[model samples]
Target chain A: MKSLDIWNRTYSRAFLDDLPHRWQRRAFLRATVKTATVIALAPLVSSLPGCSDQRSTSPPLSQAPWPTLAAVQEILLPHDAFGPGAADIRATPYLHALLQTSDFDPEERQFILDGAHRLDDICQEQHQRAFLMLDPALRDPLLRDLAESRVGDRWLGALLTYILEAMLGDPVYGGNPNGIGWRWLEHTPGFPRPSKGLFHA
Target chain B: MTDHYDVCIIGSGAGGGPVALTLAQAGYRVLVLEKGPWLKTSDYFKDEIACCRRSTYTPNLRDERHVIEEREGKNWKAQSTYDSGWDFWNGNVVGGSTNFMSGFFFRLKPQDFQLRSEFGPIKNANVADWPISYSQLEPYYTQVETEVGISGRVVAHPFAEPRSTAEFPYPPTAEHLLSRVFDHACEQLKLHAIPTPRAVLSRPVDERRACEYAGYCGSYGCATGAKGSARVALLDRAIKTGQCEIRPHAQVQRLISDDSGRVTAAEYVDTVNNIQRVRAKIFVVACQAVETARLLLLSTGPKHPQGLGNRYQQVGKNLIFSAGGSGRGEFEYADFSTDQAQALKQIGPFVNRSLQEWYFINEKQLGGKRKGGTIDFLLRHPNPISRAVGLRRDDNDELIWGQALKQRLKNEFTRAQYLDYEVFCDWLPTDDCFVSLDSAVKDKWGKPVAKIRLNSHPQDVIIGTYLSNQAKTVLTAMGAKNISGSASTSPPQNLMAGGCRFGTDPKSSVLDSDCRMHNATNLFVTDGSFMPTGGSVPFTWTIYANAFRVAEIIKHQL
Candidate 1:
């Protein structure tokens, strides 16, 4: 069973907005977004040469629902002017690696993969096309509508949770490469970071 | 072959550390049976996934789980921790939860020993006076400061307990710029803001290093051996004495007692799942509060049919957790100058401010004179994933994606510095809240697990709310925005105490004044379980002090 109690507590207190702020200087926001995107995506471009070896060891990205899952992730965190998008952070690959791990919860992994297939089915029913075939403009509205449902909401929440992990987790976990996420947010991680081991030794 | 020792300590946390150290140093053979792994300082890191997301420091719920009985309307419903994911096990490693604690150390006041006498008992609360007084534990508290490495600047506050020493052994840690703002606000509000004491080292003490000012102090293990965890401070020194033997991954099953009710040996399952027995002159049970009670309840002998110390059915009664809530206030960088903004964004320095102004409430609303609580102010933890996860939902509780989500993340992360406060009040012991063995559920070892019934006294919430509001007033004075906090009945799993209270009367309490089991002369419980009334503070400092005091008594007996 899903831990509804833990989820509820986390969600309810998420947006306490304990310190309200006025959003002034849209130009400053645009400049920071452009700078962050460049700095965050630099490592991905540099690491492109090593992609073939990683792809040979791992499952191919062309796996049926993986393409659909990637599409959903892109919509959730699109390549906007604000910062590096889901694709820039390699969120799909990080998630794929996480699900493939032995320690990862099998039930949760199944839930995520099943949700991607369900999203495609919903798209086919509503728009007479698979989720990937749907127009880019039409995708956000459908996702918003899907958020209103129980299963859809949890599915989206799960995806968003993994997305955050990919964005902010340590670089050793196959995400946040070159400390891109940390650089973007000016986050200073604690010292003696996990380097030798995959998780705890 | 069974190994014999002068003293055998079960569990190697705060309660067991001092006993092992003191006994071993005094030329006695001390054996510490720890259920967890012996993780060294080099093994610790600040990985958020390993420390927080995964059960790296604790056992998986699938193997060992708890059954929590929470109130539902008039009836109570019990749920396994495996299903709820509400892990009851703190740190299952060598040092126990002390390895993960933020190290906020506070001493109990003199009145806390005699809560019933200081203020008349509340209705339905099992309030009682302690057999020992603050004066008795004062020197040991000082001992913990010197021995366990406490660092703070002591100032005269409204509720400052009588101390044997004028100052802490070590100087206060490096402070954040926000502490100045907190002090100024307290000065303006006519409130005394004391420097919060920490068990972390401010300077290098022998082999142990000083605090590196790592932002991940709580939840994450100390990589530098700066935090005064049981392993780093006490157990390590005990090992150096060559008289202490710490056997990790030795899960104690039960204590074998003779017909005379004296514990002869401890039967335990080793790492290889082989049952091993260790005979000792005296046995000390310090498996935390819940497990201590569960161990006692499971060990039913010929003389003790009910349990070891459950003759009067007081072994697993009157469990307590620290009652309080946490709140945060944000300081926007836009409202400050460039230098001020830069200072606000600086990480790593500690925010060591706390308020005890309302430690004693004197108002008509709370019946004129009553107990209040402590408000500790700190910087919001710098865990990026936790912060990003919190920003996933919008104001309407709907999932926000795309640009909206990105904007929210940026604003929440880089735009402001958040100052948070945690309130600590007494979780008044009640008859409803206690620990028992669950018959239906069992651990991986097939032993019955602890079933805890959680029920807080109504006055606890009242006092908590009063303290929370007072904390918000401080935040407001500090020019903070959108300050919010509330007290709830849900217990903080880490700060647990009681269940095997120590007192003068054997019929009413499990342990005697010296913390020795009244019925079983050779058995003693040294954890927070001996606390009859947990003060309005974290129990680590008091537990360490009392254990040191108990160690002296055990030395005499040996």
Candidate 2:
């Protein structure tokens, strides 16, 4: 999975257009398609990458290869004077967990995995190190190149979706701790906000 | 229990729900075959990923997809559903799309009933008059407003159609602070900024609770069962009567007809993949517009070759999808006075407002007299994940990431509040837009899926563009900064109607004035399929009203 070859063709722009335009299709998809996936993604941050206790019995992320994806997401949407960033909300691990779930399409999972590898390959060639090891100063060039390419746009769009989940999605799903994202933006969530629990998949 | 029923209805949304509730209450054994499972109140929650990002409530495009055909110059190129861009909207759950609808209810004016008579032939457009008048359906419309639980204050507006009832059953709830801003702006423009009528409930009725204002309206199902969805308002009541049985996960394959040309049975694949058959005295086909036509075309028997009621070749012709454009305007809270700023910060899920000033077509829009559309003013969806994803810019042509992209997103989220605008214009059916069985593509069930060919008439775009400009003007009057949005050529695939058009003539239409098939005496179509012309607004209310009207006729005949 070096490139987009493994990404499911069903999610392609051509396929999305087979219905209507992208933004509109996505608007309706909220109620029609993603309900179960929303509950499935919900869980406490699962004891970040390495620091875990004996009581922690969640899946291990030792070989998950999430750092490059994390670095890219952080570089793409870092926290500044504008509210919280990917680092504060744990966007990378939230996305990693989402990709591992049954709710995500198998092909979409392959696409994300392949995109991370390709991004790392480009980072290594430019900065003389793997993507995660690259200096914060040098990460922009790789993102610039990826953003400029057609293949990289899908990856960017998908990453942005998860980043949004981290910022605005229900906190039970391992992001937006303590309603910080909602308070930052002042978005009045509809009543009956969920408690911490996963809906049956 | 008898395997036979008094009525066998396929699909269970606005089209079938009302009729099922009415007939079952009237002591008729009604069997409703829904393609999806029966979701409970506990089943629905604020799960954005499951309800929006994945195919949990709709047909899995990977297994079943519609083939869309695009016409360029001289060729019609086909695109398979296998692609991600393929429009895969439309609910497969028991309540159908109504379970997730925004519930913006607007009645079709009297002029909409006679499009062909009002506006003479306009080149290639296939606009026509509805077989029934708005007056005929007005009483049923009132019934839905009360029984189905519509909540809004009816005001006297120039662009509004005539009302049969004196007032709505319930007063509007969830009126946001932004609605007053729109009222002020519209007062400046002298446009009728009517309180947009929503099908969602404002107060508790019987066992259901009032809207919780969860901000999760639209895409997610109502946990409180206050949205007036079929499952909440109609099916639940019908179940208590014990006469209505909803057979979930039963996909009706075809309508089995008798030698006399009337549909006698519904053949379907049950949940366990067994081919189950149900006999009925009367059959109603309300599987939505596209699937309704597809099912009829797929039922090729010895007596009906082209398909059921396709002998006149009018079964799948003249399909119309509503065309429209959308625009969003942003306003900063810092610019407003302290009182206004406080109100702006507290905006909630509801901001029901729309201008019907252009509901009737005028000459200024088309350079000549013609039919026009409506403009709906709304608040941006509360789903923050979609809002952030919406701000991401990586369409390949331009790329912004890292700090620059992050800053842009933050500004969009926190800087200023946004208002959404949508123009709903009529899609005049032409020879270009219709549904047929695809030869090459097949669904997971091994059946030929619908092959849709869509191309909107040029006037549809012109009227929608004029209405969109009017929407921008409202934003400008309301002191919105960077206000922009225009009409597009894209048709809203979900708001589909026509195909199995109803008319008095057997040669020109598929159904009679009562929505009964012209050829089959006992078969009826109660969905949007019988609509010859979908008016300037959404068709759900009209579909529900018409279904209620048809239910009366069915009862009379029985």
For every model in order, the fraction of real contacts preserved is: 0.48, 0.44
Q: Least accurate stretch of 10 residues (summed lDDT) in model 2 chain B?
A: B393-402
Q: Flag regions of model 1 displaced more than 4 Å.
A: A1-58, A198-201
lDDT of 2 by residue, B175-244 (tens): 7778988899989888787888888888899988888777778878888888888888898899999999
Residues B287-335, model 1: lDDT tens digits: 8999999999999898788878899999889999999888999999999
TM-score of the second chain in candidate 2: 0.97
* Docking verdict class for candidate 2: acceptable
How accurate is chain B of model 1, given as a TM-score from 0 to 1? 0.99
Following a full C-alpha superposition, what root-mean-square deviation does model 1 have from the true structure?
Answer: 7.6
User: Each model: TM-score of chain B?
Assistant: 0.99, 0.97
- The C-alpha local distance difference test score for the whole of candidate 1 amounts to 0.84
- Count of clashes in candidate 2: 36
The whole-model lDDT of each prediction reads 0.84, 0.77
